[model samples]
Target: MLINCVAYQEGKKLADIPIEDISEYLSHPKCFVWVALRDASPEELATMKEEFGLHELAVEDALRGKQRPKIEEYGDSLFAVIQTVEPHGDELTVGEVAVFVGANYVLSVRRDAQQGLVGVRARAEREPHLLSIGSAFVLYALMDAIVDRYFPIVDALEAELEIIEEKMFASGAGAQRDNIERLYELKRKGLVLRHAVMPLLDAMGRLYGGRVPVLVENCQEYFRDVHDHLARILGRLDSVRDTIGTAIQVNLSMVAIDDSEVNKRLAAYAAIFAVFTAFAGVWGMNFEYMPELKWHYGYHMAICSMVIVCGYMYYKFRKSGWL
Candidate 1:
């Protein structure tokens, strides 16, 4: 769907023009048209291709959707695919925005993305001086907006990890299974973020310094700021992933410790019962010639001996912290 098609000249909004008039605006030396679309139809893409003289391969990638986040150059124009990530319950919803930027036009096609770049256009209009730099400025604005959204997600992930860690430690050997499951889920979310940020981090590096793209040459500083933001996010994401791994291991260790304590308790009980069983078995043999069987206090002596021996063994077990 076509969200908006507007033309601009000399850092100011001229008017909201129809798509057909885009070519007319392109003819002017200092004018450019900005277009936004959401889940555009194939027909709309073909029309855009003809109107803007977009490269066929770029159009195909946009039409196909799900292109890896990247930036490709087609002559003086640039095609960039940026992934849009949003937190959805416990999962991250991944989306894509394909941007076609030329010297005089910028066309953004958003696919499977809930949020739109409408605010970007508003902010650009509010700052005419930066918008005056032409399509490159718009590209940077769109990318910056997308990259800025990543901060909140990273913050949320950090908060979640802290919560899980606190609960796991506080409960100490309790609910270990649940803690491990939550940690793994948190790790999955981090992976989603990694998938979104890493590729773009690499892609953004090319826009600044040492033979940059012609369209973004004048606006390298803005793009560099964006690159820095991506780097920060990537760093935080790596930290979260590493902490999650550690948390998972700790939870498993707690489980193992709990199991070991249970086994020790069981072994201690078995040893105490074994002493009584041994005494009872020897007495139950009932040898007719056994002298103790004829003694009047023989039963009392056997009972007292068993009690004394069992008590000593129990004391030892308790002292060793095994019972």
Candidate 2:
């Protein structure tokens, strides 16, 4: 669906034009059109293609909506895909935004993403000087908006990792299992966020460095600033992944140590029971050859002896920290 189709001239709002009128405004040298769409259909994209002269391959990719984050140039226009990451419930939801930028127009198609570019539009309008730079500045505004959204998510993941780390050494069968599961979940979310940022970083580099696009050449510093933000986000993402890996390992180690301790206690108890069973087995032999059978106190004396032996063994085990 077409969300908005507005034209701008010299960084000022010219008029809200219909999709069919886009070409008329494009005829003006100083004017540029910005079109926003949400889950656009084939017919809508076809219309856009006719109006803006968008590349067919770029339109197809945009229509598909799951393209990896990237940027490509076809003749004078640039096609860029950016992944959108949003926290939904306890997990992250991944979406895509494909932008087609040319000298006179910018077409943004968003899929599976709830966040919109209304704020970006407002921001660009407020800075007419920057907006006067045309579609390139608008592209930067959109990229900056998407990259800024990532910070809160990164912070959330880091905070979750910290909580999981604290629970790493916690003692409980259920708690240990929960900690491991949480760590894995955190790692998964980190990868989702990382996937969104990494590709965009590479794409942004193209805007600022060698043979930059004509529309973006003058805005190298702005794109560079965005590249720096993505770099920081990527760095933090790496740290989160590493910390998650370490947490998983440490949790497994604690579980192993706990199991080993449990086994030692079981062994100590088994040894104590063996001492009593040895005497009992000897007495249970059905034979007149059993000498203790003749004495009335034999049963009592045997029981006392078994108790004393088991008690001594229990004390030794306790002292050794195995019971």
Candidate 3:
């Protein structure tokens, strides 16, 4: 669906133009058209391809709608695919935005992404000097907006990691289990963010320094800023992943410790009972020649001996912290 199609010249808005008028606006000097689409159909994409003279391969990738985040050059024009990430309950929902940027036009096709780039256009209009730089500026603005959104998600991931860490050693039958599950969930979200950021980081890096795309060559600084933002996000993502790894290991260790404690108590009790059983078994074997069996106090004596030995063993186990 077409969200908006507007024309601009010399850093200012001219008017909202019909789709047919896009080519007409492009013919004028210092003018360009910016178009936004949401889940565009194949027919709409084909129309856009004709209007912008977009490369067929680029159009096909956009139509497919789940291309890996990347930047490709087709002569003087640039095509970019960036992933959009949003937090959905305990999981992260992934989306895509395909951007076709030329000297005089920008076509942004969004797929499966809930957030719109309206604010980016507004921000660009507010700063006419930057908008006047042409389609490159618009591309930067859109990327900046998308990259900025990742900050909040990083914050959320960090916040969740801290919460889990605080409860890492919490005492309960299910505490460690719950934390391990949550850490793995958190790790999965981090991986989603990593998959989104890493490719863009590599793609954006090419827009600045050394060899650069002609369309964005003049706006290298802006692209560099974007590259820096991606780098920051990547760093934080790595940290979050590492912390999650350590947290999971710690939770596992806690589980092991609890199991060991249980085994120690069971072994201690078994040892004490084994001693009592040994004494009872020996006395139960009646031998006619056994002198103690003839004494009237023999039964009491044997009972007393068993009680004394079991009591001593119980005391030793308790003092050693085994019981």
Winner by lDDT? 3
Candidate 2: residue 165 lDDT (0-100): 79
Please give, for residues 1-323, the per-residue lDDT of candidate 1 as tens digits: 99999999989999999988889989998999999999999999999999899999999999999888999999999999999999877689999999999999999999999988999999999999999999999999999999899999999999989998888755546688888888888888888878988998898888999989888999999999999999999999999999998889888988888888889989988998898999999988999998889999999999998899989989998899888
Cα lDDT over the full model 3: 0.93
lDDT of 1 at 25: 89
lDDT (Cα, tens digit) per residue for candidate 3, span 1-323: 99999999989999999999999999999999999999999999999999999999999999998889999999999999999999787778999999999999999999999999999999999999989999999999999999999999999999989999999999864899999999998988999989999989988878999999888888999999999999999999999999999989889999998888889999988988887899889888999998888999999998898889889989998999888
TM-score versus the correct structure, for each prediction = 0.96, 0.97, 0.97
Tell me which of candidates 1 and 2 scores higher on TM-score.
Answer: 2
Candidate 1: which pairs clash? none
lDDT of 1: 0.92
How far out, in Å, is residue 36 in model 2?
0.8
lDDT of 1 at 281: 93
The residue-level lDDT of candidate 3 at 110 comes to 96
lDDT of each: 0.92, 0.92, 0.93
Position 247, candidate 3: lDDT: 88
